[model samples]
Target: MRFSEEVCERLDNYVYRLIDPRNGETFYVGKGRNNRVFDHAAGVLDVADDDNQTLGSKLDRIRAIKSAGLEVLHIIHRHEIPDAAVFEVEAALIDAYPGLTNLQGGHASSDRGPMNHLELIDKYSLPQFPSNPEHRLVLININKLEDRFDRRAIYNLVRYCWRISKSRAEKAEYVLAVVRGVVVGAFKPENWMSATRENFPDIPYANGSELHRIGFTGIEAPGDIWNLYVGLRGKRVSDPRLKHSQNPVRFWNC
Candidate 1:
């Protein structure tokens, strides 16, 4: 939704709100120039592909709003402000609205505002990965066993069973990938709708298997102290007990 440079010049520097028509709720709030508001309104149909998931979910929400036969009401909260002040103002408005569909929130600032994504993650204690969680975390040993065939068994487990619980798989939060006693990546759950050729279509696989699902995402790695290392290490997902073990699916507790 690119606007001409001329239009963008005139529209620069503004914080906006999108009002839902069905129940008159404010589903989203954002700050931008060059028709960022309309971009959200227009992006409902372009759900994220295997390449990107962040933008697609926001678009999905907007599409749902439009599908309700209601249009979003765009309101300019403020305009003609200094570039630095925009972040301050945007963060304040976001803080005012307790629950907004705005996936990425306000930017960094010198004052109190919505915490940045990483801050929010730590603030809220996210990635509370538990190897023995009643939920799930599919720990993939970076290297396969010398005597094994492939990740078929681990795949079936992650795709089927819950981490700690004996019951079948259900809601799962994160999957921490470990390598030789070090945590390399943390993936968040995305959407895997089916088992078709397209099911979990976006994710890649070492075996070229279509079952390489895409419902999970790799997130930022934790601090060095939390990263797993050889010899006795920290607790939770960082435990080094699995350092020399061939087990692909290990456990971690928050």
Candidate 2:
């Protein structure tokens, strides 16, 4: 059901959740203006709008509920949110609900999303990254990193399979693996290579056709260099420009 014009005006930018009537689970979390919340169940999205696999899943779920002769439950978790603050609200909700059908994390969710007690302590205690780094640096968010303790896993996650410009990617000397705005590891790229099965025989490719992505093979940054950016204590990124927002990649001095 669509919101009335007056209700829409009062709501302004708001965060909402779509619940599965069959199980009362929130499947989607989103933020928008007007009757944007109702659009999903109204069948506004199609295969053409499948920006990611998750959107397609969301559509399928909505269809299933409708076919079962049930209506999807919509909840306005928070309303009249300021335009600037809505992203954080939406992201917080998305993090609170783990299995949401959102295509991407909330804006700046990688940088300032959920954290455990130890992570919270580390986030505040670590040294801040250089505000003006002299080295041509590429800040790659390893937010999706599954293995936090493995050095090899951190390196592999930071170095492989990214959709980026080859020429621009090669210009950077160092890549910083960031997790929740903290520089977890630093590396110096020795080579930039296409993300293909031939180039990376170790990685399992979904198909034979080479993908249009590039990754790097690198060694850990030298101790002196590492200490400057990331030490045993780790480095926290405080600069707004350095924060990993929607894009998993950001460049500095390049």
lDDT (10s digit) by residue, model 1, range 1-254: 35688977887798888777777777667777776667666663323312244465556667787798766777888887689788778877876775677544444221134344644443234333334334344454433322122234323323421123322112444555443333335444453333333443433442333232333323332343224321122122333433324234554432
Quick one: best lDDT, which candidate?
2
TM-score of each: 0.40, 0.81
The Cα local distance difference test for each model comes to 0.48, 0.83
Candidate 1, 62: how far from true, in Å? 1.3
Q: Given candidate 2, what's the lDDT at residue 165?
A: 86
Task: Report the C-alpha displacement of residue 18, candidate 1, in angstroms.
Answer: 1.4
For candidate 2, list the clashing residue pairs, or say none.
none
TM-score, structure 1 vs. true: 0.40
lDDT tens digits, residues 153-199, model 2?
88888888787888998899899898998888889999998887778
- In model 1, the runs with Cα more than 4 Å from the true position are 1-8, 44-51, 109-111, 114-254
